[model samples]
Target: MEKLKPKLFSVMKNYSKEQFLKDVIAGVIVAIIALPLSIALAIASGVNPERGLYTAIIAGFIISFFGGSRVQIGGPTAAFVIIIYGIVAEFGIDGLIIATIMAGIMMVLLGLFRLGSLIKYIPYTITTGFTAGIAVGIFTGQIKDFMGIEMGAMPAEFVGKISAYSAHISSFNMTTLLIGILALTIMILWPKVNKTIPGSLIAIIATTLIVKFAALNVNTIGSMYGTLSAQFPTFAFPKTNFQMISKLIAPAFTIAILASIESLLSCVVSDGMIGSKHRSNIELVAQGLGNIFSGLFGGIPATGAIARTAANVKNGGRTPIAGMVHALTLLLILLLCMPLAALIPMPALAAILIVVAYNMSGWRECLSLVKKSPKSDLIVFFTTFLMTVFFDLVIAIEAGMVLAALLFMKRMAEVTNVEGWKYIDEDEEDSNDSDSISLKKVPKNTLVYEINGPMFFGAADKFMEIVSDISKDVVIIRMRSVPAMDVSALHSLWNVLRICQKHHIVLIFAHVNEHPMAMLQRSKFDVEVGLENFCPTIDAALERAATIKPYKK
Candidate 1:
């Protein structure tokens, strides 16, 4: 109960005016960085540009105020690019909004249940695989926009989209292409000049000016989507059905998982920067509130942004004031500069997303993993990447997880094998040798058994194969190397013990390890094996075997 206590709403002690000013400066700079990104990400997610600003305003403010981490800036991100597009394309924007709301509720529930710490149980290989897949999806989706390719009407499916792109190669607009290239190059080079102002913003300004001044034929936002409206955001409830629910469950789950991973990661990063640990559950709840408000205000789904958090830390923004100020900055921009946004070029926005996909892909790390990691990891990694390219993200993640789990099982099985006693190394120093029993002229109706290895279901069947020839009145089962048993194996042991009792065979569990013994005690394996027949070593089992011998009636 104490561990689950909330802290996100609490105020910081020793808050200073100087730090507040720094936070404001940092917030404004981040708003600049976020400005272009929010639009690009929203466009990628299949929504209008204004939705992104709404997310930066609503989710941003909520996350800053109720969030446990001081520096985290929450908004739509690359992680949601593929998932949101798929949802909006298949089920439309209304269905997407409903799903986002569902996902928000789930995140809040996850935190309230104090499952925040358990998100780490998701394996790194699995996360890496899906993340790489999402990056590929985002990259592929943007090619049409960046290259100014026209397909009249593009298909949503991956293969169809590619085929359409290929067929329409003749429709590429050189003017748009030039603008996109200019935007991309300028964005890549801008940070070297000044970190205070974002590269994407500079790129947007440059490309917009060139296209406008030169009177180029390229499509500006005005020509493509019409003039921007200065109006604030509005909310609407979605009409849902069973089919929509079934279709959206996968995307909602994906969003929840990515949100969980990215949020915790941002919290950890902030903790390292500020030297203050965060309450994870409280942070998650705040995330849920942020997402809820974002979806309501016509924004895409959001989570903690890592780069923005780092920026907040570096600019001397040590408290949530920085994050809140960032929200206010975006709001001010939305209200004042909404009309001027029409001058922005569509290809330039696409260029920003291209850069986003590149950064998210983590190509250098991906290549390094293939070079240095085990062959199995590379297989899972590439398999996920191709799956995203060819199919959908849900299938990619599901298949990658199955592959990783199979490889893990095979590794464990390799470490857990059985060997005949004669094959044991002569000079080997195993503690099990201290319990070996030597019995000469054994009784005809008696059996001596030795068992080794883990008692999991995978290894449980081997015992049956070993004891297939047994037809004895009394049998001693040696568990010299058995260390653990899952519930399935425990039940199997219980059933076997009952069968032995039915056959009038006195059974002994010999040389049991401490851990397995505790499990047995908890599961009441003692009642089935019998108190008298249980032993810590084979020597004790050998002596106990004497009293169990029976004469023919």
Candidate 2:
């Protein structure tokens, strides 16, 4: 299991102080970066900016303290932007709290059950497509803030949101635009001068100073949303209705799935940087704890942030202390700088998101999929992206993934036809485990062909193509390698038998597995082909074919 899993306790206990110091430094830097991001994400998610800080502080701390990765920093991320916004708008913050808490519990349970390793089963294309889609949605949502448009009470639906954006286009404020661009520029240029400090913090502080000293009439967070309270979050309850829970279960599960995917992916990336593997199950449990705390503390959902994790790694974070330090840093800022934070420009936050959107959006990945990926993968990728942008993430992921799977199955089946008799030497696989099976030359008028892999609908065409290529007195198809058969495949086999009858060639199915034989028996195919013609093995089939080779049926 070392190839897939970890002994969670050992990894945690092996931590050293040297790593802790580095982690602390990295954590401090990440905290600075996460500061504006947390508030911005929370605001975008339809809650007060403080809730974002709460997630980064409370949830972030819990995740880092007990999480799987040494350097993973957890909090509200851009990926959950669309979902959290919808939940809050539909059922209010109370509903969001309950859902997050429930999902957390679910995650903990999943880890305890050791299902963490199984999460790798989720397709890569699904993650890539939806991530890109989210990037686009985040990009679009920030347009109002960046352009300083007054989109009052934006709708929850994508179509409605677009209409509202267009309607408010005339109200764009240039001062907000200037603040946003200035912040964006500083964010871009500051890091080159000092890698130790985060560009985002510098940008926020710089923009806040300009607005305050200049007495700009532009809407600040304080001007627009009122001042943030300097109080810590208290415990709260959304609701306990199982009926409501049932409805939210699917969403909660979606959150859990997303959390697993995102956290594990972050862990993988961090591993590349540090050359150390993470305890995935332990990390999952830690994430669960973070989510639970987030819900309890009036915070939004949280997960491992890839960008933040990468930043930590790059900044010399080598242990869990860095993640913990990062959390503490946010807490210190929230307590000390809450009121001062009110003066920050919303447009500046919007600019950060636009940059975030660009970074997160896999537009390049999407283009590559369209131009270079196979037809099935391309279909799955684009379909997932379209669904995510136009519809809810839950729906988009569910439908897009299902469609991709079906297409994959169809393709697999098409390549799995009967190919026993004609020429095994020419089409034989190289000296590998798969290509070990073969057949010698048969009688002049006899045919023998072997079938391979699972026989499903797609294999129907291949099955037909193989048999149609042969013209002999008798045809014997081998089915030794075929492990299972679908109904469509069985029917296709029967039809080929009928074709052999029309061609006046004796048709025989050899060495069909017991499972496939039962299916054929249920469909009464055995009666039509005759019991004697159905050989128990390829050797028996070859003997029967030789006997029937010289004469027409």
TM-score of each: 0.89, 0.83
Candidate 1's C-alpha runs over 4 A off are: 1-11, 418-454, 465-483, 502-504, 510-524, 536-553
Top-lDDT structure, candidate number: 2
Model 2 misplaced stretches (Cα beyond 4 Å): 2-8, 11-15, 420-447, 457-477, 483-553
Question: For residues 182-211, what per-residue lDDT tens digits would candidate 1 score against the true structure?
Answer: 999998898889887778999999998998
- What 10-residue stretch in candidate 2 is worst by lDDT? 1-10
How big is the positional error of residue 61 in model 2, measured in Å on the Cα after superposition? 2.3
Considering only N, C-alpha and C atoms within 3 Å, which residue pairs clash in candidate 1? none
lDDT of 2 by residue, 499-525 (tens): 877777777888888888889899988
Error of 2 at 502 (Å): 18
